[model samples]
Target: MKKILFLTFAALLMVVSCKKDPLDQTPDGKITLEEVFTDKDRTEAYLSTAYSRIPDYFWKYSFFAFLAGITDEAKDSDVGNNAGNIASFWNTGSLSLSTNPLEAYGGQGKGISRYVTYWSGIRDCNVFLANIPKASVANEDYRKRFTAEAKVLRSFYYLELIKQFGGMPIVDKPFEVTFDYASLKRPTFQECVNFIVKNCDEAIAEPQFPLRITLETERGRFTKAVAYAIKSQALLYNASPLWNPTNDVAKWTASANASKEAIAALAATGQFALHPNYGNYFLNQSDLSPSPGDKETIFEINEASNGTFSVINSIPSKPGMFKAGSCPSQELVDAYDMQINPIAGGVAGEPAILGYSDADHLQPIINNSGPGPASGYARARPYVGRDPRFYATVWFNGAQYDNINGAIHTIETFQGGADQLIKNPPNRANTHTGYYLRKFIDPRIQSNQPHNSRWKKYRLAEIYLNLAEAENEANGPTAAAYAAVNVVRNRSQMPNLPVGLDKDQFRVRVRRERRVEFAMEEHRFWDVRRWKILDQTDKVVTGMEIIKDPITGAFTYNRFVTERRNAWTDKYLIFPIPLGEASIIPDFDLHQNPGW
Candidate 1:
């Protein structure tokens, strides 16, 4: 009986030992957000999550949505004959709420989207802001600066959301797991803009925050200048015809003032200026320097480490080329004005108002008009004597494309030659427009080498154009506006606007200037939409059909309408809210844009 009692006591002891301990039950690898915020390193890494979510159209995810294709600027290689390619689908206006492209699922897949949803990014920003005070960063000033920067980021995400969807539910706090999604309602357009402005103001109010970043280590972070720039852009969009249908002159004045303020802030830094080479600027020539800052880039998506492979996608479809995507349109080519006699008051022979004609596009008829000291162009070369930017931006049939590693070869976009429909059939890898983009190309890039180029999100030139547009609208082409535009013109070796242009004439000049200066940089598509001129611009897309004679070796260029079916419509002014979200909401029409 004593032995049995001892065995029972041992069994009871084993049971007590095996009982669940609270410490043992805790998860090993998991960490609470509070723990994340309290640690300096963890908190900083957490802040980077917000930065990482910025829409990267140039890189891995949405490379095919080259904005040039959908606009008059250029045409993408016929990526799809059917409605399978995402870029083609986007260009064709086949978007639906159920099949929204908010993710990075490119092509006909399920991952790439057009960046319409940013709630997760917004949540990240809110989390950072709410928990930052709890972080134990020893540098008190830095903590304050970081807080202000977080505010700017929050504002930026809102700006992105508003620009795409007009307005969104302004969720300033992180939603709990049990939070009701159905109750969320999008704010008013004006309310959304005000919220963004308020965020900018909060960031600007921080005395410790700097106007520009001088440290190379912190290149892509938000700055006081960037905040102001965002404000300027948001205000400008608010004043634009699409959003401001009532023609509110006050909004224009506000936008002009905001832009001027941004310029003043940038100029105060004494580091910002126009880079001498417009073409080389986008190629990240500034990175070649050991210095921290670039004069041209106010804000940019920096890709210094891996470098961008956009060159590979954009290269002509020759034997050694990667893919003949991003083909420049004949319409964009024709927009480049051929240099003629720039007489003192106005161009000679042409009307004072109209700059150049089709005859100007041809070789000079006479010795005076033709290639000489007087005419500036040669007869054999049809592409010569155009704007200096034209040579930098386009690679035509006869132009020598420098392959830095080997001998320079003439780009053959003629019939039976390299990179033409006659020699290469029309497909995703072939050029539909018989022209290739030369802008943002690194001539030094060889087969094995990679290109590390900067993609400008905002720059001095764009700000100058913004200032000119806003000032022109507010004060009718004031001296400040003229000087602002002249800054961009002189940089590109183009002539200044003719001396006596009326408001309408000045407006036309400004619009054309914007088109040529910002071509293939993703501005034309949005510019048309905001200007309420998409109907005119998006009516038809054109391409150049080059017929080359085998015996004579002569080239005949004919322009033809390549893609029809007006992609522009009233519904497209603002993209529809993702249908997945709309269907779940009560009174779906109230939550969605008109007609899905």
Candidate 2:
């Protein structure tokens, strides 16, 4: 049943092969645009081709591993002699314009060759918009809405480009095959922002475009809310230090207003709100958000095909199970607060796990409860009393795995344990950081049940965070700013930011909140870059090694720097345009990024 559902969705997304020829042109056997517009099905299919090209956050073709490998969020353990070995790249920081995984183009082959340039995707959107008027779809309203969807999607593609490469060429309309490549010059960063905002406005102005889609079958389709979310995100990026380096307060004001507009539009629909359980929101279980009323997720990539290997790859390679991939680093695990003392009845003598200390974060030395006999802290059981999200997101050494099969199993990531480095095969199994991601791995997956793990692109929680950051920057931590961030904190059961925090203090809180909230969701990699703090945050990747005593059966934990984090510079802020594209252009306008 799930397979059929996947197939139907995939059909709507109509996958197209990568363009073999550099110059965009109609294929010899391809039907003309007039013929396509004359038939409703063919026209819709043409638009679906662009939809299929929407950048997938967790594309299974890339081994279901993400940019998290390089960031502090997690470490990948796909260490082998194969062509796809990037474990060293993440730690070494040796990525170049020709070999960076973030801008990988060409085709979706195995390993690092999994991203698209999106130039062809944007071209397809332009063609669709140009030819949509002639479509005899019977419903004028549907055609208008379809055109709006194309426009929003095109703007989103541009957002993806600008976020990574800064200013980019603004190609609004389709050009002739004879158009000169050297004539193209990237517009200013502000110009690119204006282009995206203008496209979003055009989409929203369309009368047929619905603010929110009410149908379950079309849950993942673009809507007015999606456009607003994109606008809010783009504006927020524009307000960031990377773009607004002068600390322009007006940019912050613009970003705050855009975010408020998104929140207002979503609130008016009464169809969107924060999901109560932050942890279960990622899982496909119906408890948190049943179909038709899923209020939290603003935008998601509904997988268009079956046979996704990401789930299996993420599953820990047990005695005879799947290969382990994407090991969450200790750096991420330490970010979760230790809520409860491992000892019962709040008794003392147990080592305190108050979370990372201000002095030395790598070591867990803070005593949440001041030195006392009633404190229930325990060093061996540090997972207790942490945020609810910690359990849902990280699979630590002693964490329980009750979601799998019918019985409960304790995850043993300790030395020589079930998921430990030595226990599993060294070549293709085991975790590099003695941790695994539990957020998106469905428990019923091993039972062969349908798993609906989705990569949520935008959610209300993110908007709340965006509002908090922007509001504080613009208004110096007002009540409204506190309220926005408190919404997310309250949902996760974490305490709100202390009252009377100055603007700079609140700003620091907001940044840390983003890291904890969106840990493994692929947000940190860009957030640090945009904030221009690569020198401080991207210094080193660390992992935890546990040594178990055979006689006493006790475990000793040690934190050590991993080999993947070596060199970094300010030049890594924006990815270099692929050498393939830059080399072909004869003009200085298309030069590679500095220090490429």
Candidate 3:
């Protein structure tokens, strides 16, 4: 823990005064903070490095893993090394506050990569901001704009900390090497909110919030509205009970107003809007534009036509896209409403488990000659017939799973053919999530195809969810929540829900709608945390299974779920400060969360 913190602090320090290195320069070379910011190329490179450090593969911090697996968004019956534990704890809503297996909590070795890297960017930006004016060179405006951007990134990290662990320290500038650990104390939650808002103010006061398109140069880095959106998001979370369990009405109201102001201001920029089709939102490497009539997008961090084709890295690395991902959870599946509605078909009303005879052939019903169910299922009948997002989010039995061949493969509990997990492997092997994920990755993109397959880091969908949560809290949202939800729903060709529903009911629907709408985009776990609903759900280890009859007769009541199993606990929510760090800091509390 000390080593990690030490590294974090050291990184911050370097960010303070390090100068930019030329592209041809060695990775390890000395440049004071002054020498670096003077050069535009160097400045861009330094900031890009900050973004680059956001950890790839994300076996743990990958936004999707935690979002889908750690909340009630998804669950799997079979187990795998990393996936099952994520699914299990979330589905059960029973995670303990121990060292989170997800490593989502801050630590020396393990942590949200974005947390560390983004902070480093902030530190670097601070160094530039402080030194740019004093630089022997000119272009003061350029240096300050970059400095403003650093503030935006730093604020972004604080937002992450707030969402994951409530209140935390705000370190805007790089500290001297002599900064004392004993002096570091978490600020009041209000302080954190104010700090972020202040940063947003600085960002907005400057020429851009989300770069006014006019400033074309302010493209991806923090723009004026991006700051507002982020502040809005942060204040909204602050208003949430997770940050104020006691219902501090004043804090809640302030946060709502702050966020509302941001929303209105950002809308005024006239740069953002809703993308038409939800299906188009998931970019198929084959096509660049989104699906038709799906234009409800607001602000999005686009990965389109960008990167080294790294977005689809989660798919198996060899055949389709990459071997990095494909982890889906049944917990996620149950959340999607059957095309009909979340209330009617999705999990809200369905039985938790089902009973079936091993002899009952699902293939005959599904148009395949496959065996049937097991004698019994452990829990309750799984939920079904829900929202359209469910179909968009997962692959169920008889569902068409896309890939190179581009055929819809039926979802079945492992009827077991060797290599079924393979694309050409005749049999189907389910992912640890109990179902297959279909949101971010498009299976059709192949090495031979003229496309780049990868996950989108940001999209219009998340903003919609954010608006739903924020607007619902600020005002009894009628069109706000409905518009937000419809923005995403219509993307997938679904009908819009009626507007002006009850606040409580609308809140529930939107939350679930986000789960299905942005399944693998990595929103579920954080959504549950912000909504303060993790306590109400299960947190057990869930996994994948063959669901075969153990009896294995020609036809009998014999079926079983089989796969490597994993577990999650209550402590998993607020990651414990790794054991090593707790030992060194006398003031630090080892108050590991309950289940740890």
Candidate 4:
């Protein structure tokens, strides 16, 4: 019989009011906390439960549902068609405190229940930390390491919470059933950031915690690097414009220092660096492996082998495919830097040569616009001479794509083509943006084959970018900041930023670099929110409308609005607190976000 540890506390009842599964019952159908901690296996099982709340970015039910769809980066095909699609809730502006699709308060759902499950996970961590010392079989070293892991996990949960809901009620311990839950209050955003940083520091200082996890068995466990990564990311978010509206240089300096410390700590081990091949880094299974795998990956969630990702995101013309999932927006495609400047007489290696002519990304900067030498960009042939990352990320009209059976097929997204957007009858399964997602879809995974896909939560490139942004904001684009951002650009074979950019110009470059570098990686969703640029970005998403001439075989490209999102208001800067939690508690101190 399978045994289970149950924390029947009134605090838990306030959030997760569901009943336990009968299959998870013990032989006697009940196991107490004392009975659980006395046994090493049960104690370890309890700790494992705490790790279960980490958001799975690949699945449709979790935060992934809204990450790409609600942003200007892509338009999710699943919206408006798929029942219970969470992205639709945010897309149509139908989301309310009571009607939150992402909230899994009952704890009987598939995806990561952002609010209730995370709180439950935090409670589990608290219980494990308080009782692990009582485990008879675990030695002192084992107990210490386990305690540090729980602490790091707790901090991680808090970080995720703050990213979505701003400040949250700090719950450090597992309260009893009789404890007054109404007495809890939300702390200030800075206080929450400090608390998370403190927990991370505590975990890092633990003597039992290894600098890096070298053993295959301990691959996903918390390490000193993971702790540092959590610290760096939290500090970076806190220093962002949304949180630090005064543009505090001290906050930026602190974020930069944290990122610098993280980079130095990892560099000391000499095991972490950027992967050479950008495309193969996501496709190759070996690159996603632990330790001996891609050294760039600081922390990743290894998901079960499932081949549906390729079919779901591929063009509808592909055999055995379902629908095009997140179609890359024309705005996103225009963010890639051109190989040569779009202006005449502009040579190779010159910096700031982006493809678009304006901030709205409506006009393409074509070759030979002026009198001198050609810029290498052509209006008709838009795909040629662009950044290499563009090819790795989006499947354009003429791009060659591999099928499940290892067959090469060219995707044709032009009007009347096989992958065209069929809107006459409104076939929502087609690509709305004239492009399909090419990143993170394994070409080798056949229909019957199962392949393990890893979602990188924290990587070395992000830390470098974080350092660059923080430094640029703190000290107005210093040489150190240039070197950091240039490392990431050089790795992708793109030229470095120009030498004479001021603070504001360098800031624009950093944001653009992040948009292209981390496209579709769940970064764009939060980056815009943190930067407080959602009003400009999320207002309208554009797509390419390619019309092919029947007689001359010439192509005409036009930009059209794929979606005009309604949730771009300032209130959307942060998600509203779930209705149940906000309304159920009479004296609940969790105030709703503005304009909610």
After best superposition, candidate 4 residue 470: deviation in angstroms? 0.7
Query: Can you rank all candidates by lDDT, best first?
Result: 4, 2, 1, 3
- lDDT string for model 4 (141-253, tens) is 88888888899999998898889888877777756434565566767788999999999999888999876776776767877878999999999999999999998889999
| TM-score to native of every candidate shown | 0.84, 0.84, 0.70, 0.89
- Candidate 2 matches the true fold with a TM-score of 0.84
Q: Model-by-model lDDT, in order?
A: 0.66, 0.68, 0.48, 0.75
RMSD of each: 10.2, 7.3, 8.5, 4.9
Error of 3 at 519 (Å): 1.0
Q: Candidate 3: global Cα-lDDT?
A: 0.48
Q: Which stretches of candidate 4 lie over 4 Å from their true place?
A: 1-10, 13-29, 62-66, 103-111, 284-291, 340-344, 349-376, 403-407, 584-590
In model 1, residue pairs whose N, Cα or C atoms come closer than 3 Å (at least 3 residues apart or on different chains), thus clashing, are: 97-579, 101-113, 101-114, 102-113, 103-113, 104-111, 104-112, 105-111, 105-112
Candidate 2 stretches with Cα past 4 Å from truth are: 1-30, 59-61, 80-83, 102-116, 217-219, 285-291, 304-319, 338-381, 403-406, 421-427, 447-450, 549-554, 584-591
Q: In candidate 2, where is summed lDDT lowest over 10 consecutive residues?
A: 4-13
Output the worst ten-in-a-row residue range by lDDT, candidate 4: 1-10
> What TM value does model 3 have?
0.70
